[model samples]
Target: MITDRHYEIIVYGATPGGIGAAVAAARRGRRTLLLEPSPYIGGMMTSGLGRTDIDWLDASGAIYREFAHRVEAHYTAQYGTASPEAEACNRGMFFEPSVARAILEDMLAAESRLTLVRRSELLSAEAVDGRLTAIAIETEAGEGEWQGRSALSADVFIDGTYEGDLAAMAGVPYEVGRESRDEWNEEYAGVLYMNFGPSKEVLPGSTGEGDDRIQAYNYRLCLTDVPENRVAPGKPASYNREEYASLSVDAAEGRVRSIRDVLNILPVPGGKTDTNNHHYCMCSSDLPEENGTYLEGGREERQRVRDRHRHYYQGLLWFLQHDESLPEAFREDAQRWGYAADEFADTDNFPPQLYVREGRRILGEYRFTENDARLAPGLGRSPIHADSVAVGAYAIDSHATRKREAAGRNVALEGFLGLGWLTEVYQIPYGVMVPLGVDGLLVPVAVSATHMGLGTIRMEPCWMQLGYAAGVAADLAIAGGAAPRDIPIDNLQDELLAADQLIGFYRDIDASGLMGKAIQYFGAKGAFRSYEARPDEPLTVERASALLALARLLPGGSRFPALPAAGAVLPAGADMGPRLPREEPSPAAYWQRHPLLTQGLAGRWLQAAGRALSAGTAGAAGGSVSASAAARASSPAAAWLRTDSAAAAEGGPSASGGAGEAAPAVSVGEWCALLYGLLLEARRAGSSGSGGR
Candidate 1:
């Protein structure tokens, strides 16, 4: 290992996030140091956890997308485009573990400014006055001893390790395990899963209580059904038959239905499989009891714990495949699948990285809680963060931590945290990446979040997105000669967008689609600011009408108003808030009465309105317009009444309540269209209706 090298950005833990950060930083011309404790570079992705669980819609960053596309391209190049491997590649969600590793390495190799050091551990971190100065690293010498020691200084440090080792060593304040519900007002926080099964024994902390226990850890097994790539199961060095005593009994009594009942064997490209533990299965490698201590353990201690887990899981696999007491069919099926000989060639086809679901999470500037992960109370989506750095779309899914018996059935607590039934997309703010009161440090992995909150943002894609953001933030900080927290968020957002990092979900509307021009038009008129517009969510009648009123006020052919920042924050009760005119009480009732005011009628109404405005006609059918309507319309409100009469005369549905027609809901895209139509008519008439509603 080279000891004389100094880097502009020092990244620890070569996980997916670390790779992303190192690449991003190096691309920006900053000399970067990427250090991995293990010999492998790709952490989980290379370590048999290849069945990616990603929310493709929210994965908008360039780096992550590029990585995904490369994986797809890899499969397509190796296998025919019409092959099953190509199909999985076309989907771009899952791939073989080795393929992912190769893609990451290729990307890393392209960067001239990156230095990769493997099998090096973080021995100590020197921080002065809440600012990290230097980090001491110990490179592995011959045998298990680390005789080579070196220290490096960097302008910025990024902790991309799943375990948060660098951040913990830097003296960043962090937490382990769940927090009480009261702490963050999180519904899934603290002790959960108390009454899930037959166990009467309460966790030391009662239900909904806080503790240091973290989610379970496991090795993602890369197996293969094809005999060509299969390596038969072998007895681990530390395996003990007694360790799987309960499993043997359970199998004999027919408690275990099938090997799949407890194992998640998801297929990847090239006939490989990414296998994980199932909730009801007795084959889990999760060592929940040792997790708390492991989280705080040193390298040696952690290695021992990892070894024990390996023995426990391997022993269980051996029992399932060879034990005579188990059902014959189950054993046969288990024997059909074996380790993929082509993958993880260095580790005898076993994954090198362990799945550390949760570790020491920094209590950063903003602690993202479960409340933030859930849908906004009144809105059907999540809130927009003014300082968002990335977008995350996934459910808060946490695995069980401790297993116990309840009512003669096995139960697990703090294992599965289902924060919400629906998978909602949310913004990850920049504040959470900045540890509280820390300087020159950014934590993209194991960020400042509650255990439940981490569940949603813990996916590999999300981590890579955060890593990209960190790299940009570091670049900006260095250029401005300022600390991370001191950099203006607006400027940072500018840089993020330049790097193709998605910061917010809003304004992600298609720029080339039908709504593109309309969104640009209304966006200029400041009409969308009335509410946090989820351009993706279905538009309610209330929002549709409000958008119309705002559009009518803008003069036809007038320049679009200056657009606000995508996620700009405004004081509560600001005039710019969605000032949608309040409808008569029972807004739903009014819509029911005038079904034509809903979605399906928007096109017809626009046509009629255009004709009425063109002819300068008013007072058709002699119905008087309401005073409020007259005050708001630049042209006579009688024109609207005439348009309604014209529609009625044309054998179309009348605006004054159709003949019991159903009110069709409008989507945000549809609302944009209607708004566009209205703007066009006003422009043709050369009139502008100005002022707030």
Candidate 2:
């Protein structure tokens, strides 16, 4: 029997990114459906990966930040605000798998427009004229529309699954594994062996040649020491003592002192820790070369790989706990920990999800490379994306893709790289989400990126940001009756900014504020002197006027509409000329005019504009004029109104300030911020057409 259902957006996978996409779409008032192959949600965050991969909180966009806030609130609500549970919540980034799952479930339940189908699998999909019109799904459980074969039709389909299953089924081209170093001129491309790196050292036999090998996959188990909530590891049917003979040696040699030495066990709330492979450990959960075909394989092959991982991990745990070959002290430490009884209660107390680090990445509009995330040459930041919808600061590192000789060197772990090196704040362009040839589809999870590029983009925080963007973009597409790729970037960005999502990075300021937004807005347009937007520096009122004038020209653009005669939509990678109003310079033209953001000359346009803003808002007695002191500047014209409105929003100068009393010292940052805020408010006032205010 077949069933039919219609929704504005359909997202598959129920991973963190899937949940993010579904929830954002629904919250934006679009009817949405989220399908999970498993009966669970929140993927790793709710499974075994309780630790969120985020360091700088500002880089985290709105959705992840909201999840973090709610997770903390959950603990505080259950156990008082000052309780140990609340304190251990680590601002919601630290939580048990169960807590994470429950929190996400609650979040999904609160969204009335979203319908989540559990244990659903994608059977096939249909497309016409390069547009996906519908997809077929089969749910093994539940009842009625929730069970059996069904056809789902939507305006837009977002593939949020870790494996890019939806996009693949829709016939979007994809790449798996590493690319040649020369392919994208990426330094970390292909087989890698890091000896030690203050700088990256390529070992002998290390080749930048392309290969199909990808980083290893493993389950991040949630283990607890609580007597009442502990399920001891047992011997798996596939356990072979010969496979773990090396672990015994490590324990005797002090390389493996306890379970902690082999597995990275991080403390979360509720007396449990999320455990995963330790990169430099003697032995780890990661099994290299075992997962090579999992990406392109059928359901059975994929499940076989997952089962292999389960047996390998379970056997290792049992070996650590019960094997007499290791010292009693080491065994005792391993014995203290077991799968948390309250977590993953189904499926034999084991995490049901396998953390697929790298999957089938769509060969989409733009293939992001390491260069996209690295600080370019002398610049302090990464490449500034014109259509930036999200920001990421995580290091571009991956786990072992190929293990070394069984006895050789753990340091010889091919493809193993560390964090905190060669990564700066980078912006992810919307093009990554737009798959080539597929109009109604967006692949936010398995995005278009080289293996090295996926190193950072693969993080849950970054994927969630992309997922959230795709959600908003999908709704915008529906509203305009346009394809996902044709959604106007300015509209998407405006929505992101309103929700306090980080489209651009600021070191000393908050993007949600007008000052931060203004600077980031222009920065995205390549208006900053360099890539940096140092918004806190003082500026003259003379400079501020020019920038406010400049801000006026940066307006929303029309979607690169299809040509009427040809009647063909621009393919995903087509160069959409000039992402700015006709009045503004192209990014190249602007780049040549300004170059890098220099610190000298009022700062040089954050130098030219910063100088201009500082001169206009807070200049020297002869040159600059703050809001209170601007007698010459204080005519009740639009300039005064603009500055006044900015000042009011910033809580700096009073609304009733008379002409030229005594202008306070205004920073160039403040002036830009104030002007930007006024500009934003005026823009949002929507097609009133800047009534001269």
| The candidate that achieves the highest lDDT relative to the unseen native structure | 2
TM value for model 2: 0.83
List the candidates' TM-scores in order.
0.73, 0.83
Q: Highest TM-score: which candidate?
A: 2
CA RMSD, predictions in order = 11.6, 11.5
Error of 1 at 382 (Å): 1.1
In model 1, where is the ten-residue run with the lowest total lDDT? Answer: 562-571
| lDDT value for model 1 | 0.69
The global C-alpha lDDT for each of the candidates, from Candidate 1 onward, is 0.69, 0.75
Residue-level error in angstroms, candidate 2, position 544: 4.0
The Cα error of candidate 1 at residue 54, in Å, is: 1.5
- TM-score result, candidate 1: 0.73
lDDT score, candidate 2, position 534: 62
lDDT of 2 by residue, 1-693 (tens): 475688889999899899989999999999999999888888888878888887766678689989889888999999989999999888887888888888889989999999999999999999999999999988896645577888889989999999999999999999988898999999777877775346555676667788888999999998999999899988999898877778788777777788888888888889998898986674688988899879888889999999999999998898888889988888898899998888887788899999999999998888899999887776677887888989987888888877656422544578777646778888899998899988899999999999999989998878888899889999989997888787667667778877878888877766666667667766776656464566656454445445655655555111111111110113245565644445555544543433322122111112222223332444433332331222223221223322222242232221122231233344656656544443444344342122120
Error of 1 at 679 (Å): 23
